[model samples]
Target: MITILMGSIAIGLSLGVLGSGGSILTVPVLAYGLGQTEKQAIASALLIVGLISSVSSFSGIRQRLVHWPLVWLFGLPGMVGTYLGAWFASFTTGIVQMTVFATVMLAAAWRMFKPSKAAPETRSEPSNWLTGFQGLLVGVLTGFVGVGGGFLIVPALVLLSGLAMRTAVATSLVIIVMNSFIGFLKYQQVLTESQTQLNWHIIMVMTAIGIAGSLTGQRLSGRLPQQKIKSAFSIFLILMAGFILYQSLPALFPAFTL
Candidate 1:
């Protein structure tokens, strides 16, 4: 229980400070720290992350920093994709799932470390078709990894939709919230049995502590060195990938000894 609370604090702090590293932490925390199977870890992380993100998003809402229309444009398609992705995940082997998820984390880390040079500026509402298409892709990716699509959504909002970084973060929260709720519905049956494996006491404990951590961390965002924080956060992400690879890779290649 204590460990789960700590993990939640860790996740919330990451999200509050960096905006996108929470999911990377979430997958590992649930899988290793909480002793959940890979699928359960991914699914549970989706729920917890969504809820936490919504809480953290409150500041953005207060400041009117969110691009509300864009969120709906992206979130709807993402929900569809999430369902498909979760369906596929249900059939994959544990090793395959972890490897795929780890690969995604590495990709997200790389993107965070070396973001696109293009900066967003104010713009009129985007064309419906373009936004819908982007949402579809983001949603599919979200479903596959059990993430909220912020890693992709932030960049997309900035580059494609001309949203500022702050706005992107705020809008990404909506996507996370909506997709997670819908995606979880897809995994409802699986989660019922998983309830036995899940440490709910830990979930509640973690959420309470994490909310405090997140609130504090977000307050520090503008005051801190963002690039330095992002760099450090990337390191944590890479470490998570390494951990996932270490635990799941060997099982896939049983003949190998390492």
Candidate 2:
């Protein structure tokens, strides 16, 4: 329980500071730290991340940082894709899911490490069809891995939609909240008997702490350079990806470790 709490603080801080890594870490914390099965961890992660993101997004909305039109354009298809992805995840093994998740983390880290070439003033409105397609793909990946998919969304918005970095981050939160809630709902329907009984006490504590951490992260964001933060976060994600692959692949192929 202490370990889970500590891990939750890290998750919250990452989310608050980076606006994306909370969901990515939640599953590992639940599964490794709390002794939960992968499916249960995934379900719990969706709910936790959804609630945290919902709280975080209000600030963006209040500041008019969120692009309302893009929210609807990107979110509706994302919701559908989230539901479908959760349904598909129900049939997969833990090792398989973790393997795929680790692969995605690696890809995200690589993207983050690359220098951005986007010009702040170069705004281009992406077609609705392209935006919707991107959203759907992100949502599916999010549902499958129980992540917010902000890493993917932020980049897509900047590169495809040509939104500024701050706007993209804010907009990503709105889409994450939607996808996470829908994914949680779909995940619930397929829960096993063991998975049905969740540790609400832990979850509530984590949520509260996470919210506080996110608020702190928001404050820190003002003091920190975005490029520095991204660089550091990219390194962290690379390490995490390696750890996950190491843990999951051995389970999938026992002889590999032998």
- Local accuracy of candidate 1 as per-residue lDDT tens digits, 14-86: 7787666676778788788877777777777777777788798898899999888887888888888888887
Global lDDT of each model? 0.77, 0.83
Q: Tell me the deviation in Å of residue 118 in model 2.
A: 3.0
Model 1 steric clash pairs = 78-139
| Model 1 TM-score (2 dp) | 0.90
Compute the lDDT for candidate 2: 0.83
**lDDT: worst 10-residue window of model 2:** 192-201
Q: Compare the candidates by lDDT and give the number of the best one.
A: 2
Q: Which candidate is the best by TM-score?
A: 2
